[model samples]
Target: MNQQALSAFIWSVADLLRGDYKQADYGKVILPFTVLRRIDCVLAPTKQAVLAEFEAKLAAGVNPDPFLFRKAGQTFYNTSKLDMRTLIGDPDNIAANLYAYIQGFSEDVRDIFERFEFATQIDRLAKAKLLYQVTEKFARVDLHPDKVSNMQMGQIFEELIRRFSELSNETAGEHFTPREVIRLMVNLLFVEDDDILSKPGVVRTIYDPTAGTGGMLSIADEYIIEHNDKARLVMNGQELNPESYAICKADMLIKGQDVSNITFGNTLSEDGHADAKFDYMLSNPPFGVEWKKVEKDIRAEHEQKGFNGRFGPGLPRVSDGSLLFLMHLISKMRPAADGGSRFAIVLNGSPLFTGGAGSGESEIRRYVLENDLLEAIIALPTDMFYNTAISTYVWVLSNRKPAHRKGKTQLIDGTLFWQKMRKSLGSKRKEIGDADIVTLTRLFGNFTEAQIATLFDANGKEVGRRMVHKGEFQPLPPEGGKIKLAPLSRIFPNDAFGYRTITVERPLRDEQGNIVVGTRGKAKGQPQADSALRDTENVPLSESVANYFAREVLPHAKDAWVDEEKTKVGYEIPFNRHFYVFQSPRPLEQIDSDLKQVTGRILQMIGELSA
Candidate 1:
């Protein structure tokens, strides 16, 4: 069945939840039941064989796990004789039978249901006398692996969560990303490695610290498989939310993947894959979320472990921990002597230029740029997320930069690439369509300077667009139309985003107008800084501190001298500043004419009213 019809059919189960449960509470019943039914259908084909093997193994007093797995031909097995269809046989005691069936599954499968709190839903449904109906509604549908591929199942899962999110006015973005965005990121993550990834039987590993339904990992896996059927991508992820974690684990389990790779915990406080390294990683961590809860553990490591720990460079403000995840991903990068690694992460604008020089955020940016870890940063369209309408950016980094790309970072402006969605989902009113994704990928892959020309009619509505590579002739508009040519891609030196925030201080003077000199050891003969006149200025890393002081500061204060001890090197990606274009105001005659016309219209209205 198509996704819409399938989601609609699954949602029909909620019809039984009305009156007995709040609209927001519907997911608690629907999500778990849907997963249970899918699992039930998958285990049904070998149910009889698995149960017989279990009985025979028990009679012989041997471990049934291996035998049961062999009989089921899957990683997990349910040994109970009762299935969903069988549970429906006893409507009066269906709840008890359902519990037994769940308990009989292997530990991994059982853990999925446990994380979903399926037992509580069973008790609640049974208490409300809706247990049998809900079970029957779910059982009637067939979610066999043969009928529904893993991809379609994932879409159904997303649709269900989106519906629940819309009903409760919550953001599904917190649980998972919109797939188009994931596709674009995955494209960029693998764009530079076509040669290595296209080989048959090639094996690679992918990780996501903020797994969030494992959407990123699954998409990366899909990309690799589509790349080469023989190529394999091992997936690993960790999620903090119980429900998202359950959905993620269940999806992985059904795909014949090693579900143990997907873990559950706060990655910051507890490293789930402590010693694991990966060839590629992707994450859409909770943007602007606080790391205060794990501050103690993270701070201890930053101080104690230094460069040996994940947060070695520095820590961002506790209020927003987005940078922390970047550091963690960096730690997980395979050594350059090895195959090395590449990663993409979605972050809000804050990380680009929040903290000042010498601060944690600035230091993190400094470390990244100074070390040339950043590869490219793509600016996404605003309102593209389900939660907030704020602008977001995708940062792609790698330790093993191509020879030509060394010491350079590419920035692709994708803010204008989105198309309006036919239907809005929560805060998400726009989406990056396939065409947009291709354009973005091309811009990054080309890694050359380019501009996009937007044609607008006299009415000022956009009518056409085209990309012009550097040195190419710009596209022109039709008669009576105007064209806007803006830079679509730009490459910059790594140090372009680096600067030194120097503290400029003036000399202290006594009431008699004499400079006050310090009497202490270090400052004995030096002029005492006037605290009131102290200020700071960011000097570009390309310019020497003394030269900046001489050119910009000395003219205003002749006595000003550099405080070399207080100088601090910092970095920030002023993304918008690099692309800003100035527009001149209208001429005086034009302004006067427009005001006169408006005044004439007001006088005409007044005369008509009087008449």
Candidate 2:
């Protein structure tokens, strides 16, 4: 059966769980069992050989780990002769047999069940007199990789998790990101390194700090293998959610990756991969979530380690810790001398311009832009995630920028690139199509300014639309119609988003219009600035502060002077403002005519009523 059908079949087990298990608790039973069956089917072909190897090695008084792994052709093996089919044969002894089957697996696979707390679930099911039925239901489904590919199985897992999360009133997005989103991130992460990545036997490391179900890592691995069969991606990540961690580790195990690479813990407070650096990384951190829970640990690191730690640039306000993950990934980047690193993170619009000059958010932005590490930020369509419908942006950062990309950052307006989904899943009503993904990837790869133009006919119907590179001639508008243009892609120097906030002060004046002289030591006989008139102006980094104050502020306030001591460098990427397109409003005459037509019809109706 197909993935959707298989997922449906597995979800059917919930029918047996309804009265005994709360709707929210269905996943506690379903997810682990589904994983168990998948693993069971994977080892089925080699089960006999692995069991034989186990016996042969034990007889020789040698360790059987290597022999069993070789025999199973996987990182794990099951030693018990009781498969799910056989365990269900004896209805009364199913629970005891099921425990034995679970115990037969290697330590790694056994750990997965332990995290799932499968024993507790087993007892609960048996108490409800539902264990045998549930086990039998799962056993009937065929989840072999040959029948349902690994990619399909991954989708099935995510779908189940999404349903469970929704039922439990939890954010489904926390468990996994949409596949298309992961695909786009993977494409952006590897787009610029095609030459090196395409080389045969190319090996690289990919990590995700907020791994969820390892969607980002899995998709990246799939992307590399698709481009070059011999290319290999070693995946690693850390997750805070126990269930997600278990599922992610199981996924890696099934794909033959070392499950130990996926660690369980809060990435912010306890980094699982503290000693490792990766070549590529991707993450979609929880939006606007508070870091108050881990504030003590994070603040300690910032205060004690300073720049030697991940959060040294600056700490965002406790209300939103999305920037913390960005800083963490920044710290994990492989040095440019060691082939460097590229990463993409999904964030809300706040990080672009959340705090003012010298504030934590702005300082972080300043650090990134000043270092020329930000490569691009692509605005995604609203209603794209599973939980929240707010607009999001994907930031692509790299330390080893090419000559063409050095000192430059690209802003891609991809908000119009999504297609409506057939059915809404949570808050996700839109998805980026394969063609749109290609279009976006190409725009970033080209690294040039471009505009998307839409031509409309006389009836106001859209005739056509196409992307045109900067300096390229625009296509003529439809005859007797008009064309509208907006920036689809734009490139700017890193300094473009940076500015200096200069405090402007005006001298205090007395009632007689004389300068009010200060009586203090340093300010003796000098005019004191009026506190009420004090103002701040943001001077673009490209412009001299003195020149800007003279031309803009001084003209308006003749006695104004800049407070050099208060000058603070800040950065903000007003993404929408840069891509904004102005359109003149319709003429007053047109509005008047339309109103008159409606008024005349109303009068005729009144006259008919009078008659």
Clashes of each: 0, 0
Alpha carbon deviation, residue 386, candidate 1 (Å): 1.4
Q: What's the true lDDT of residue 363 in model 2?
A: 92
lDDT of 2 by residue, 337-403 (tens): 9999999999999999999999999999999998999999999999998888998999999999999
Candidate 2 whole-model C-alpha lDDT, 0 to 1: 0.92
The clash tally of candidate 1 reads 0
TM-scores for all candidates: the values are: 0.97, 0.98
Query: On a 0 to 1 TM-score scale, where does candidate 2 land against the true structure?
Result: 0.98
State the displacement of the C-alpha of residue 565, model 2, in Å, after optimal TM-score superposition: 0.9
Clash-forming residue pairs, model 2:
none
Residue 452 accuracy (lDDT) in model 2: 98
Per-residue error at 520 for model 2, in Å?
Answer: 2.5
Best by lDDT: 2
| Residue-level lDDT tens digits of model 1 in 1-611 | 87779889999888889999999989999998888888899888898888888998999999999898888878899978899899999998898899999998999989988898899999999999999999998889899988887888888888888778778876335777889999999999988897546778788889999997788888888888788778888889999988779999988987778999999999999999997899999999887888899999999999999999999989999999999999999999999999899999999999999998889999999889888899999999988887778899999999999988899999989998999999997788999999899989988888899988889998888998999999899877867889888888999999999898888889999999999998999999999999999999999999888888889999999998878789898889999987776667989999999999999999999999999
